[model samples]
Target: MDLELRHMRYVLVLAEELHFTRAAARLGLAQSALSAQLGRLERHLEVQLFERSPRSVTLTPAGEELVARAGRLLADADDIERQLRTLSRQPTAPRGLRIVAETIHPEVVNALAQRHPGMAVTLRHDTAEDGMAALAANTADVCHGWDLPSVPLRMRSGIAQATLVDEPMWAVLPEDHPLAGEEQISLAQLRTAAWVSPGPGTRRARHLLSVCQAAGFTPDIRYVVDDQEMVRTLLANGCCVDLAPPRHLPEQGCRAVRLVEDVRARLFYAWRRDSVPGWLAREILEESRDAFVAGLVRRGPLYARLVEQEPARFGPLLDIDPAGWPAARIPVPALVSTA
Candidate 1:
């Protein structure tokens, strides 16, 4: 039997609550009915996903994995439903654009709205990986994020991407940290420092790994996290160091220093081929470039120096070649973008 979306949802709720009674109540089903449905689901998959006792409930290892997969599946399903609903509306009605981004400046969103009075834009924030997944699944029309020379995002097949801004990565150190006063810091200089980073195997994590390996030492990752704020907090406390482009400098209690290495971060937007309207897409690209560049140049100090040093490099952008996608790019002046 094919597993249904509803069955996955049932499993998700049960996994979260870890109790049949609570999950059933939340789903508006009786305890017995919920149990019967779970039994059918288990038989269909031929796997016992949960271990239950009179006293408590817990997931089997397989259950744990399914819970994670279910979340992505459900999100994609919801995205598809939303897109269908929007498409089913009057063809001449003002169309809505759903954007999933790790970080999109407010000025860009405001500018897009101002430029296209008829377009409805929705911004949803998520991790870069999840945002790309949404774009791939057709839940979102576009995703905005940064692609670094060290950590290029893995684009899903068939997606077309355009670069908007290029900026340089910086070492984020405690305000009083020894290297904090330096205008630039070398990767080798940071080799011995404790680091906080994204989880292993993620594109960003892998990039950091490669960077460290090239620097002749491994990063002593003291914390594995997905939250940028947590990384900043750890760095500010003098516990560890993290990296960001100059545009995404730590908000407080840390200093940003340019890296001597040529690692660059390119701000980019990816969408399904032929999904976005030509006018709106071009407007988005233009506004993204303007807003990003304007912010960096206005932010002063590091921003001014970077633009002054590499103006041509930040001008007009290019798309990732579909054949090699993120791994291959047509050579141009290298650029890095801030958040």
Candidate 2:
């Protein structure tokens, strides 16, 4: 009979065990059966594969060579089997997409579910830098975050990006603070006041420094914290003031006042080059924009007052005219308290 994979496996096991009974047990066969099979295989090739004595068994020189070759052959065969299994599943398996971002609104997730019901979508929270790294490693399909000019050129290369919103930044102040009553605050007016900045060495920190410098004074940053709740606590306690975008809804103890300076924060949707199709990327961008607008509209009277008071600044956000600003097509659910 022609040799088969089973025969190679048999010889390899026997060579390692060096005992017919032990090798047979390992192979889940009776000792007599293993011996008979090997004997037939040897007779077919006219070779003595093993030297046997009543006390012990050892491999012949021919057996040694055969075992070495069998090891490599078995490895290759196993690899082929694994590859074939993977190929077999490709046709039937559903596609999966992963998005890395600081936050993903529930509305966006629901919209994607309605658009591509079969595609599985996973959301993970990470900084913009780490999110881009995930995209480069092919572990994530997209990233959503601020697009600041301070980001490294190396990180920007080989990535496709779409800008979702470009809006003015706002000053986050304690409700009891002196400047908090103002509808708009200038950076220069608060240059001497204590400030809460993000962690040093981060892109946000650098951007804050640059914006402060443009207003003619370095920020007197008294606290460096990254957690939003902690920052809000500090502001609520009247410890310091911070800058945030309009999308960052004001909390109970804080107010979001528009900055007099023209400084703006840009929101971006990004993906690796050729990793996501152009059409799919655009769909995500559009969905994200709509969800963001819906959130602003749902921010209650505080934002509504801003839209009414500063029509030139906040009016474009709610413009429903088809030619001016695109309104959300997806249904906006009732406002849920994030507090």
Candidate 3:
């Protein structure tokens, strides 16, 4: 009682072939079945769609009209089916893990790659504020940076954080500076030294200012540079001194002297509460912590001495057990003495 797509196909095929046996062969049906199906279609529509003779098959005027409409309908149906198949065959875009950090460690990234081979990973360096904003906006999955308690509660509402490491803030001075030779220097001793710090209004800059004020002298900030290399250049040229953690101190041009006051900076791994799965977040945090400690272990004598002499200060890193680290991957020499 109702028309179907098969009826349209049958009508068009028979019309094109003009022979029941030939049309049925092309349609992969028995000739009798094709004829019976056509009869059913005509009866349903209450009209003959084909004229037949012993010697030939021909389209009736009704058949001609029906075939004209059926051809268009069948063409549209085929096109839709083709489009659907093409869409089905196309692969969906791969899920990506985007990370923002102040410093990207290759070992951490490589560990992530090994753990999630199918996942696409990307890392970029950005300020802590921007990194937090990216996590809130769903543009980033994770962020590695200094923990700032001064961040407003609203900005941190849906963010989860884990402490990665607490590194002591060292005085990065020119290798030949007057106080560079001191095993430990007090902040008061550097009161007259010109300072190179991050740009004004940044969280780091604000923290630096507060730290200096607490240390009993306002630092005469002579140079404001955000790039680490440029900051190193300024220090290397003996233009200014700056505070940095062991990992951030320049290897070639600066001497990192321990602060006598034991000032420390806590590095954090942060992410939106809902951005990553719980297991993945834990894995990333663990891997980041391990990589950071392993890097310190491989950072030559200074950090080795810190780890060796001040195991209490670095208890968390020691808990992870650097002795378990693969010797081939990260060559860590015995921490016998300070450089």
Top model number, lDDT: 3
- Local accuracy by lDDT, each model: 0.75, 0.76, 0.77
lDDT of 3 by residue, 290-334 (tens): 677677666635766776677678644655433443233322222
- The C-alpha local distance difference test score for the whole of candidate 1 amounts to 0.75
Clashing pairs in 1: 166-336, 167-336, 167-337, 265-336, 265-337
lDDT preference between candidates 2 and 3, better one: 3
Residue 123, model 2, lDDT: 90
Q: Against the hidden reference, what TM-scores do the models get?
A: 0.61, 0.61, 0.64
Which of the two, 1 or 3, has more lDDT? Answer: 3
Cα RMSDs, all models: 24.1, 19.1, 15.8
Per-residue lDDT for 28 in model 3? 94
Tens digits of per-residue lDDT for model 2, 1-339: 999999999999999999999999999999999999999999998999999999889999999999999999999999999999997865332377788986667788778777777889889987777887887788888888776664432355667776565556788888888888898889998898899988998888888899889899999999999987788789878889888875564466777777878777666677865566665676676677676766666663454455555556643254542332334453322211111
lDDT of 1 by residue, 262-281 (tens): 77667778776657754456
Worst lDDT run of 10 residues, candidate 3, spans 330-339
Specify the highest-TM-score model's number. 3
What's the ranking of the predictions by TM-score, best on top?
Answer: 3, 2, 1
Better of 1 and 3 by TM-score: 3
Model 2 pairs in collision: none
